[model samples]
Target chain A: MSRSFSTSERRVLGALHYLGFGLFLAACTAGFVRTWVLFGNPPSIDPLASHRQYIQLLDRKQDYESAVDRIEIAQQLAPYTAAVDGLSIQGYGQIGLGLLERGHPSTARLYLQRLFLALEQTTELPSDDAEMLDMLARILDRSYELGTGAEAILKDSLLLSLLNNLAWIRATHRSDSIRNAEQALRFASRAADMTKREDPSLLDTLAAAYAEAGRWQEARQTERLAVAQAERAGVADVAISSMKQRLSLYEDRLPYRE
Target chain B: MSQADASHFSVTRLTGRSFIHPLFDYLVIGGGISLIATIVIWQSGRSDIVPMAVVPLILLLSNSAHFAASTVRLYTKRGSFEALPFLTMAFPCVCLLLIALCLAWPLRLGMNLQSLYLTWSPYHYAAQAYGLAVMYAYRSGCLLTTSDKRLLFWCAMIPFLRMFFCIQDTVLGADIGLAWIAPSSLYRLFEPYQAGLDRMLLIAACAAPLVLLIKTWRSSSGAIPMISLLMLVTNTVWFFALEPINAFVWATVFHGLQYLAIVVIFHVRDRLSEPTNRHGKLYHALWFYGWCVLLAYALFFCLPQAYQMLGFGVDESVWVVIAAINVHHFIVDGYIWRLKKGDSNRQVVDSSAPAAAPRVSSPAGL
Candidate 1:
């Protein structure tokens, strides 16, 4: 079935392939350097998609390891992407709580520390799901409404996260509709107690909740303690400065709102 | 469908069994260029020698070109517009609607669509490799027994299997590696199992093809064609040897070359088989490729720019459109290349002319 070909036809065909290859290669090269190099190729937008999708899904699935892996990648790919960093903040908080529940406090602290630094940097919660904060608020409100006790409604880690995250949101969110000082105090006190106040970040959240409730005396005292705890624990200088700034605000009888 | 129309095509081709020339097919379409370039890059140990723009350039030339080639061929093949009504008439609308949905719901639909494309990419590459290998074998008058066919199929699949393992374990371990949609728990729990399995998969990726070759050699007493073997090895090396980031760039380009080569061959063949085609192979090849380039530019560049004009971010406009284009190509290829009786693709398999004597041997139930 092999068809015979003239020698010249074979040469022509082979030459044609070379020509095609050369032309395409030349076109791409010229197009790339002249146009794309001047303008830039489409920025790889992997993290833009990864921000909302991977971290939230993995965290919800309680796949902490994979969530951490994705968080690391997203962070590496787009360092300042608020959505990704915010998702990482939430992811790390959940992962730390999960690890602690599994009796890995040392590992838990590692993730919690990352969450702490990330939270201190961001002025607002940029977690991919904008409704997530509302969801946390809803969960907390429902738990309180259940009358059976918030502790009974959520697992230990979930309860702690709901308390910490919602308290932070209520105490510092710019929207007055979401802020409720008394509720913030209630959530923060429970979180402080749950962490035994040893965690400086939780203490700071409790202090912010205190400032929101207009209890300037307790706010100053709590913030002073938070600042001390933060410094004693060798927290980052930027965070210590932030805590100190909040301390000053309470000293001036001002409530912090981000 | 009629005698006069059927008579236009000469028996398979008027040349030796290899599509175009054996040298042309083997070197350009057979993964030879990719293999050589990869070896050179690795041996040089200086990946940076190539500018970063080369990535996009390669994508434009090879990746984008080959993808457009399928669509161009589908539309240009005489009677295809009549044969594939949905594909020609309505399927583009389907693709357009899908793109709009993805654009409107970037998170819900767009991410899923993007992930689908990412996950399907490697599988598509492997499938094309397997396809081209088999087509080359058919064209070259190589007879593959049933067992031989099965062996070749699995051997070709080693690349996918290797990728599957590297991702963590299962397919959907189909990693969170090349695949965008893998569960974390499977990827993590299997972490301990991964190292051992990777070694096994690596061994298998390398060894399985050799076994297939030896077995086929013993059974059929015919050596597997060099092009087929090259395809098997190139796919394996593409996933394993090249750095993952670089692999994405080079593999697509090389695979693009392979696709463009065969698609050009088929396209020219189809054109020439038309009794009315007054042009020679070179003219037809250039015309087809030129259209592919134009379409590629329009699809990849201008469409994205148009989306940007409509207030989409450059990211979604470019990537989502790219993803949609790929899914369209993949789906179209799945249909256009089916080799059934009375199918245009039957000519691709049949070595003789349309009514030229019976095929010396069809690939089992090809």
Candidate 2:
């Protein structure tokens, strides 16, 4: 059934094959060079870079699953890096909260559990930013309640932030049942020690815990320290002014209310 | 003209190599379904669950071997050098260079290549399904007209078309290189019509084959061969019946098995047909498959470890390397397995059981 090829046709086919082969090689090489010139290092397989670029857009879409996946990939590609942790904290916090809002707390916990399979990877967990305070607090609270083992993987700064937020929430909550002055003081002290009492906000939280415990003298002293520390640390004017107002409230033996 | 007699006649007329041994061909190569099981799976509810760990294991075994089979066949097949000189000689170097470049700059070019592979994968599977369907028909002496072939082609293409509707949704789903890439603005621009389009595609994917069966049955005045129907329905089910991830898992395992079986058969037959060869069928079969398995291990496992030693992450090397291999397999496969260009793959089109003759014209030109 083999058909004999004419000399002319065979020549045409051989030329076509060679032409195709040359075009393919040239195209791939050109593509590689163009990509290098345009992107320097295309984030194609660089999870960390991709995560950074798409984090905002992912959040906007409430695509928490994708966000968590990207975060985990970034984490795998560059473990223990400050940038990876930054992404994880922002991403996991948002994902955990979004999952909760979507009534997927169990799924959220599963994601957290998977992200940090071993506790040893937690040596340099991401620290907190002021902007991430609320997000981390809510996520940590859910973690504790769900017993998701998220705490076991926490870095020192994030753990400190978690303790500070819990103490602040308990000490200043308007609902009496939610307030636990004794537990709040313990948490506040732990958070302050973790930061070596350097963080002005931790000091402010300590003042709240003291006032909630009804120790006005220590509360006033702590509030004054918080104001002085905030000013010394070159904290924002609004934050320093707030610390001063809290100082006055402590003088009146009144606990802060959130 | 009697109903029972006509049915018996149809069954008696359908005879071939089974495209291999009957049981293996039906159960594994036809994809997770036996001769009867294909029919049952077609009626069963789509599966929701996905196998996470089994996928990598299957890919390690089947994907690497099946992919390499085409290349091995191309190089060793008689007259391939003269027929496709550029592909046999220069192409290997090209593939090697491309892989090296991908490994070097994985983030940009490597990542895009991986996406290209992922995107091309289903289309490759669909094309293979169409191919095997025709091969089996020709082997079993079914004289299909161009119209019948057209209907079957569309039926087989349903899966690819469905994937085309949502390539980003179906294939990557944020799995590539860790990016939650935004669908293009054009994708969003079509959002208003997306839901309706999706519904239509899914419905068409599910219904096209049944329509083909009925149309072919009526037009040809006989049942389209059972194995051909099985292939179409099985392929569609692999892509459409199960959830996307689960479909991916099943498709990989069965498609790999199917490819491995057919390629092994061809390799063994070619070696046996050699006048100077002393090897028996079993010897050649085991030899080819054993080497395929070993080579797969070298390509997927050891090579990646070697790359890792040369300072690439295990995941990065494995992911990109496998993607690059898939791209190579898809391209070379088209060349080697082509039924035209003086390569009829007599091993397949002439694959009928010994002593059987065509019911109509010769299938050599199929």
- Per lDDT, the best of the predicted structures is 1
Among all windows of 10 consecutive residues in model 1 chain B, the one with the lowest summed lDDT is: B357-366
Model 2: clashing residue pairs?
A44-B107, A45-B107
lDDT, candidate 1, A58-153, per-residue tens:
766767676554444333322223333344555666655544444434444555556655655665455334444654454345435543323343
lDDT (Cα, 0-100) at B83 in candidate 2: 74
Clashes of 2: 2
Model 2 lDDT per residue over B1-366, tens place:
888447534764343237556667666655645223334444565432235335455565676678767766776688886777657655655765686687787667667786677667777888777777766766655556677777777787778766665544423422221122445665667557756866787788778767866775565434456666667777877776665655665676678778888787787777777789998988988887777776565555444444544565444555666777788788887767765423546544564533343332211112
lDDT of 2 at B71: 66
Task: Give the CAPRI rating of model 2.
Answer: incorrect
Off by over 4 Å in 1: A1-258, B1-17, B168-182, B348-366
Model 1, span B1-366: residue lDDT tens: 466333222333222256667678667777777788888888887666567545556667788888898889887876664556556555665676687778777656766776676566777777877776666555544556777777778777776666655653221211234334456665566667766876887788789778866775555324456677777789888877876556655787888888887778777877777788899999999999999987787666655554544554444545577779988888888766766576555775574532233232222111
Query: How do the residues A1-258 of candidate 2 rate in per-residue lDDT, one tens digit apiece?
Result: 124556776666567557645654554445345434534642132212333445545655667677655444433333221222333445556765655555545545544543433323555323333335455556666665665545555666667866886788778877776677886797799789878888899999999999999999999998888888888889999998888888889888888887
iRMS values for every prediction:
13.1, 11.4
